[model samples]
Target: MTVTLKNGVLDPQGKAIEGALGSLGFSGVGHVRQGKVFDLELEGSDKVKTEADLKAMCEKLLANTVIENYTIALD
Candidate 1:
């Protein structure tokens, strides 16, 4: 699962990173937003059920649903 703040949300960390990049002379890098990515090894074979469970996990604990959004991918 990956979690990130929704568009228009204030990202103080992202802003700080952008400033640091500018100070280091990395030009033209615009709007840096930071997020989380998780790699999970699942024991289930059912794709539908696994996705449902992952969504529940994101909603309940992994993400703050009010200001963040999450996406899940299976490999």
Candidate 2:
């Protein structure tokens, strides 16, 4: 699962990193956004059920839905 701040939401950490990159002589870098990635191993083989459960987890705890968005990618 990946969670990221929504567009138009202020991202101070991203901004700070962008500034630091500029200070380090990395030019033309802009609009940096930060996010989270979760790697999980589940016992179930049901893809549909697993996706549902993952979405529930994001909605309930992993992500702040109001200011963030999440995506689930399975491998």
Candidate 3:
């Protein structure tokens, strides 16, 4: 699963990275957004059930639904 701040959300860390990049001579960096990626290995074979369970986990703990969005992928 990948989690990232929604549009218009304040991202201090992202801003800081942008500034650092500019200082390092990287120009034209309009905006920098940072997010988290979670890689999980599941032992289930039911794709539907696994997706539902992953969504539940994100809603309950993995992500702050109020300010962040998450996308899940099964490999």
Candidate 4:
């Protein structure tokens, strides 16, 4: 699974940090995106099960349908 930021949402915290960095002499910065962290353990240690479980978790609990997006990867 993969994660991404929800489109058209105003990320004020990320934006403020990005704007501040520019004024402090940082250059060539384009987009500063931010998202949430999702952590969980499942019954199986296989990649397919983990991915499936993560997708279900994302749909059920880890992400907010109104504002954020998320993805899953096995460690």
Candidate 5:
């Protein structure tokens, strides 16, 4: 039950920032992709609750709801 940045999504912000940095005389920088990861240590939490909590977190805080995306892993 993880969500991550989908392939083919244009990362304009990342590209712009990379471009700016390169223009500042810092070359050899390219291929910028922005994404997020969430690490959770559940204290033996139930599966349903964990999923609900994760979903809520993504909907509320983890994700941008506009541009940025996120992914969660149960490790």
Candidate 6:
């Protein structure tokens, strides 16, 4: 799963990264947004139920829904 701040939210870390990249001679870099990635291994094989569980996890704890968005990808 990937978690990221929603648009229009303040991203101080990302801004810092952008400035660092500029100082490192990396040009044309802007609007860098930082995020998180999570990898979980579950015992279920049900796609529907697993997806539901993942979404629930995100809604309940994995992400701050008011300021961030989470995406789940199963493979």
Error of 3 at 46 (Å): 1.5
Better of 1 and 6 by TM-score: 6
lDDT of 2 by residue, 3-56 (tens): 999999999998999999999999999798899999999998999999999999
Decreasing TM-score order of the candidates: 6, 2, 1, 3, 4, 5
lDDT agreement of model 1 with the native: 0.94
Give one digit per residue, the lDDT tens place, for model 3 in 1-74. Answer: 99999889999999999999999999999998899998888887999999999999999999999999999989
For TM-score, candidate 2 versus 3, the one ahead is 2
Superposing every Cα of model 2 onto the true structure, what RMSD results? 1.1
Clashing pairs in 5: none
Off by over 4 Å in 4: 1-4, 41-43
Q: Local distance difference test, per candidate?
A: 0.94, 0.95, 0.94, 0.74, 0.70, 0.96
The Cα error of candidate 1 at residue 52, in Å, is 1.2
All candidates: TM-score:
0.89, 0.89, 0.85, 0.75, 0.52, 0.90
Cα lDDT tens digits, model 4, 16-52, are: 8789889999999877766666555557668887788
Q: Which stretches in model 1 have alpha-carbon errors above 4 Å? A: none
Better of 4 and 6 by lDDT: 6
Query: Lowest lDDT 10-mer window, candidate 5?
Result: 1-10
| C-alpha lDDT of residue 27 in model 6 | 95
Candidate 6: where are CA atoms >4 Å away?
none
Q: Flag the better candidate by TM-score, 1 or 2.
A: 2
Cα deviation of 11 in candidate 4 (Å)? 0.9
1-75: candidate 1 lDDT, tens digit per residue: 999999899999999999999999999999988999988889969999999999999999999989999999988
User: Which candidate has the highest lDDT of all?
Assistant: 6
Local distance difference test, candidate 6: 0.96
**Which of the two candidates, 3 or 5, achieves a greater TM-score against the reference?**
3
lDDT of 2: 0.95
In candidate 1 the C-alpha lDDT for residue 40 amounts to: 86
